[model samples]
Target: MEYTYYPGCSLEASSRGYDESVRFVFNALGQKLIELEDWNCCGATSYMSTKETISLVISARNLALAEKYGRDIVAPCSACYTILYKTNHILKNNPIMKAKVNQALKKDNLEYNLSLNVRHPLEVLVNDFGIEKIVSKALIRLDGVKMAQYYGCQIVRPDRGLDDKENPQMMDSLFEALGAENIYFPMKVRCCGGMLMTTYPDVALKLNKEILECAYGNGAELIVTTCPLCHVNLEAYQDKINKKFKKDFHIPILFFTQVLGLALGGTPKELGLNRNLIPFQLKKTALEATK
Candidate 1:
C-alpha cells in the first residue's frame, strides 16, 4: 500500500496535525506515503474563480509530478483534492483546455496526460485499505466517544462519486470500526463557509453556528472532519460563534486521522492531538493511563 502523498499547503501549516496523524495511522496500517517533492500550491478554490488557467496549470503540475512516481496521489485537504481532481477531470474531458493548460506547463517542463488518480486520504483508507484492516490494527477502542462525521462541502459536491452528496458515511464507517458511536448529524455535509471566514466573516460565523448547533444538538462529543478548513472554522470559530450567538459551544473538532491514530495505539503527542484548539482531555487521559 504505497501512494504519492500530497500534503498541500494547509497540511504543512495550520493542519500540520492532519499530516502527522495521517502518517502515523497509515504507517500503523503498514502503508507507505511517499510525499511529492517540490509540489506547489494547488491554487485552492479562490484562485480558480479569479485566475482559472493558472489555477488549472498549477494543479496540473501536481498531477504531472504524481504521474512521475507512477502511483496514485492521496491528498488530505478537501480543497486541494477538489481542485486537483477537478483539474484532472476537466483536462481529461476537454482536450482544448488540456492543450491550453499544457502550454502554461511547458515553461516548467510538466505536462498532464491524466495518468494518475487523485484521492483523498479518507477515500484511500475506506475504499482501498478496507475497514477490516483498520479494525484488526485497532489497539484502543473508542466505545464511549460519540462523534459527528463532518465531510463539509467540497469533497462530495460536483459529483466526485466518493460518497453520497448529502449524507456521507465513509467517516462514519471508519469511526464505527474504531468502536466510536456515530451521531446522526444532518448537517454533516453542509458548508463550513471556508475562506468566507476571512472574507465574509459575518456569514461565516452564522454558517459555522448552524453546523456547531446541529452537532451539539445531536449530542456529539466532538466533530471529525477530513478538510483542514472545516476543522479550523469549526474549532477556531466556536468562541466567536459563541460570542455572536450568546451561547457556549466548547465542542472539540478533530481530524478523523487523529482519532484513527489514537485507536491504533498512537499517543496524543505522537498524533499531534495537543495542537488542536479544542483539546481532547479524556482521550489524553485514557492514553496516559494506558501508558
Candidate 2:
C-alpha cells in the first residue's frame, strides 16, 4: 500500500528522528510513503487560533497536493495531523469556508475538493495494516522493556479521532506487539502544554511534572509518544520539571515509529535513536533481553 506523506516543519528539524523512523518502519514493512512535492507548513496551533481562514487555506494547499496522488495522506506529527484533519472537517462541512479557501488557492493555481483522507501514521498501522502483520515482520522483540504510551491531545481530539480519545490503545497495542510492557497511564491523552513551553514555561513545567510523575510511578522505564511536541516537552524539559519539583526524573522519550523500527531489526543509528536528548540503550538492552 502507498500513501502521501506529510512530514510538516517539526519533522524536518526538531523531530528529524520521527521522520527517519517513520520512513524506516514503513519502508521495512514494504509500504511506500510518497512525500508530497514542495509541501508547506500545516499552520500549526497558533496560526489556526489567530487567523482561521489563513490556517485553513495553508492546510488546504497541502490537501490539494495529496489529492493529486489520490491516496490517503499520513501525517506523523500530532499537530500536523490535527491541523490537516481539521481543514478536511471544516471544508467538508462549511461551503462558505470552503469557497473562501478555494478562492485563495486559485491564486496559486490549486484547488482542494476534499477528496483525500488525512490519517495519522498510527491509524494507518493499526486500522489500515493489522497489528499481527506488524508483529510478524518484527525481527527484534522488546520482551522486558516497560513503556508508557503517551498520546498527548492533538491526534485524538475534536474531529481527528484516531483511537479511544480518553484512553487510546493504538500505541499501547503497538508497544505490546513489540513485546514491551505497556504501563497503565491515564494521562495518555492529556495536554502537554504544546507552545506553552515557550510562552509560559512555569505552567508547562508543572504540567510536564505531573505527566513525568505518572509515568515514573507506573514503572515505565521509557515514555513512547506519537507527537513531537509532547516528546519535546516531556524529554527536553525533564530537567526543568525536576528542578521545579525537586526530584530526579530521567525518562527517555521516543517516537512509536522509533520503537517499531528497532523491532524491525534496524540499527539504533538507522532509526535516529542516538539523536534523543536522553540516552536510550534500546539496542544494547532490548537486543540482549530478547537474545
Candidate 3:
C-alpha cells in the first residue's frame, strides 16, 4: 500500500527518531510512503487558538497538495494527524471556510476538493494492514517484555473513530500480537501538558510525573507512545520530574514504531533507538531465541 506521508515540523527535527522509525517500519512491511511534496506546517494546536482562519489556510495547503496524489495522507505525529484531520473536517462541513481556504490556495495554483483522508499510521497499521499480517512478518518476538501503551490526548480525541477514545487498544493489540505484554495503564489517554513543558515547566513536570508514576506502578519496563510530544515530555523530562518529585524515574520512553521495527529485524541504530535519552535494548539472548 502506498500513501502520501506528512512529516510535519516536529518529525523533521525534535522527533527525527519517529520519522526515521516510521519510514523504516513501513518500508520493512513492503509498504510505500510518498512524502507530500513542498508540505508546510499543519499549524498545530497552538496556532488555531491564535487565528482560526489563517491556521486553517496554513494547514489546508498541504491537503491541497496531497489531493493531487489521490492517496490517503499518513501522518505519524499525533498533533499533525489531529490538525490535518480537523482541517479536513472543518472544510467539508463549513462551505464558507472551505471557500476561504480554497481561495488562499488559489494563489499558489492549488485547490482542495476535500478528496483526501487524513490517517494516523497506527490505524493504518493495525486496521488496514491487520495485526495478524504484521505478526506473520515479525523476525523477533517481544516474548515477556512489558510495556505501557501511551496514546497521549489528541490522537483519539475529537472523536476520530480510530479507536476507543478513552482506552485505545490498537497499540495493545499490536504489541500483544508480537508477543509483548501490555501492562494495565490508566493514564494512557492523559494529557502530557504539551507545549506547557515550555510555557509552564512545573505543570508539565507534574503531568509527566503522573504518567510515569502510573506506568512504573504498573510494572511497565518501558512506555510506548504514538505521539512525539508525549515522548519528549515523558522521556526528556525524567531528570526534572525526579528532582522535583524526589523520585528516581528512569523508565525508557519509546516510539511504537521503534519497537515494531525491532520485531521486523531492524537494528537499534536503524530504528533510531540510540537517539532516545533513556536508552533501551532488547536482550540479545531473547532475540537469538526468537530467531
Largest lDDT belongs to which candidate?
3
lDDT score of model 1? 0.89
lDDT of 2 at 290: 67
lDDT of 2 by residue, 1-291 (tens): 999999999999989999999999999999999999999999998898899899999999999878988999999999999889889998999999999999999999999998988999998988878899999988988987898889888888874545777887888887787789898888888898999999998888888999989999999999999999999999988888888899899999999999889889888888889899998876467777666
For each candidate, what TM-score against the reference?
Answer: 0.96, 0.97, 0.98
lDDT of 2 at 281: 70
Better model by TM-score: candidate 1 vs candidate 2:
2
Instruction: Give the C-alpha miss distance for residue 286 in model 1, angstroms.
Output: 7.6
Compared with the true structure, the alpha-carbon lDDT of candidate 2 equals 0.89
Q: Which rank order by TM-score, best down to worst?
A: 3, 2, 1
Question: What lDDT score is found at residue 198 in candidate 2?
Answer: 100
Off by over 4 Å in 1: 283-291
Which numbered prediction scores highest in TM-score against the true structure?
A: 3
The candidate, 2 or 3, that scores higher on TM-score is: 3
> By descending lDDT, how would the candidates be arranged?
3, 2, 1
Q: Which stretches of candidate 3 lie over 4 Å from their true place?
A: none
